[model samples]
Target: MHTEPTAQATATTHPAPTDPACDALDGGPATELCAPRRGRPRSEAAEQAIFAAVEELMEAGRSLSDLSVERIAAAAGVGKATIYRRWPNKEALLVDVVARLEAPAPVRTSTDGSVRDELIAMVEYMRQRGLAKRSRWMLKSALSQMNSWPELREAYQEQVVRPRRAMARAIVRRGVEEGVLRSDLDIELLCEIVIGPILLRTVLWDEAPLEDPGLPEQMVDAVLNGVAAPPPDGRSR
Candidate 1:
């Protein structure tokens, strides 16, 4: 008797290789979908070179529009296919670069939940990052093209702006809970108040230097003492 032939095993479809750098880009928390496993081992050297090339171009005052995938690939010493395989297009690549540059190390503050101290540290951090000359040009470029390139704007907000704001809001909420600030405070407005100065200074007065080294202190003081309620006898006034 002839035995029935065994059924052939179905082959699994393997996904193409992805850039491992995407997993730790800026070391921020990324979803699994965003950072897929690499089918092939990643080249650390190539990834570093690509990042350096993008940063170098931005630091040298090159317009984002002037950059192309080919130029970046050439500078990175990798083929166009490599860049394309990682990022679908130039805009996506630029967003990743901006995210990496803008994502600062997490801000640490007093463990006692002191809002004033926390605010001061946060402001100083923002001032340093926002006013840096090299990054300023890149921010300006991103802001200018937001209307035309909505995806770029969304990426910027998602990768750079939103995380910082969420952190700041949490700090404010903690302040309210710890009696450091008034319970009736408008958290969103307070965050905006602290960040407004930095935005104005960076974008509106690009040519001028920030003269006040104690600006962070000034901001914290205004938020804490200035807005704080006066004593029953008005002794605080």
Candidate 2:
């Protein structure tokens, strides 16, 4: 669902990359991420330590489940107060990480003039990203946590999902405006119907293909053909 936003260049503002301190946070040394506010600036050292500890621990499939605050503090080489000050708990930390994750690019449109081609490309994009091995697990985990943590879930939707949805809506509007797609179609429900197959495979049925180049085309033909308005024949079935 995460195609890049078209408005990112014009709608978003980027701060100047001048300050060495801020640059660290932007992907520089990173120590500047935790520069203390008033009192000698809290050590940026602990933030890096915590990140390394989290990454390494997660790589092994080990997590904060059995690990306590004291243990994570020790592993991160920061005081309990330090970790708590930034993140109330491990879930809070994970929420931030998930929000920062980058999604894959959308599927390409092989033939641009046809609405059918656009539909196929959209489905193809979803298939490509939805079939990811570990990302599926990560998605499921995040969805499960949402019910328990509303604010974190809302932030994830805002950062990750909303932009993707907006892109899809824009594409649908373009399709209709270009005269290739029917104007009567309901964009909102259409989005659900369009994406339902791949999502069902990825999240529910758990049967995404490892490689299926024609899969998107097939999905588009099936959904599009069935939903298109009645034929000109005027011979109602």
Candidate 3:
């Protein structure tokens, strides 16, 4: 997603010089002619190596402040240019690294699935994410560091938090439209009702269990059906 500003600006401002060969081939002036690319394509292997290197460094107890692009390049076995080509700065790189480690779960888009089913899927994804060792470590580290690092915090919010929140809100809105969720409730509140418990267990309480496959279903059904018992006369409290 990162681009070299100078190179990009130069390419935009100055088109390639007209080529005589291209003009002959086209039988017209080659004002739109393009030069052949000289740079190699991005290597997936190198990118993976860089991600792995960051994880390895973190696993070795290196703090965020300690991880420089130079160290990452040395560990990844790529030149500094390779890292710069992919990310504008260390904060961007680290944001990507966290995203890779977390691996955002896909939201179900199929129309055949019920609103309840989609809610369960979303909650289950969080449960599975919480169970991941690397993801848990990265989440804890990122949350603790965000307060001190505004750039990293903003990047994480824009790249990670905003997207996830948008997806959750979309799902809740759909449920309201389908009459599965309360129409009067705010979309944000409905989302919190469905997923908040799972998040509490997953992020706030490390000791809380996420191993139960039935947990997501239980949470979703509880929100849908209510936890309160009927009064003796079956009247509203």
In model 3, which residue pairs have backbone atoms overlapping below 3 Å?
none
Best by lDDT: 3
lDDT of 3 by residue, 15-76 (tens): 12211122112222222332332444456667778888888998889887789998888888
Order the candidates by lDDT, highest first — what do you get? Answer: 3, 1, 2
Best by TM-score: 3
**Residue 237 displacement in candidate 1 (angstroms):** 6.2
Q: Better model by lDDT, 2 or 3?
A: 3
> How much lDDT does each candidate structure score?
0.62, 0.55, 0.70
Q: In candidate 3, residue 203 scores what lDDT?
A: 70
lDDT of 2: 0.55
Q: Which stretches of candidate 3 lie over 4 Å from their true place?
A: 1-41, 133-139, 233-237
Decreasing TM-score order of the candidates? 3, 1, 2
- Measured on C-alpha atoms, candidate 1 has an lDDT of 0.62
Q: What residue runs in model 2 are displaced by over 4 Å at the alpha carbon?
A: 1-53, 60-96, 99-103, 107-118, 133-143, 208-210, 227-237
| Residue 122 displacement in candidate 1 (angstroms) | 1.5
TM-scores vs. true structure, each candidate = 0.67, 0.55, 0.76
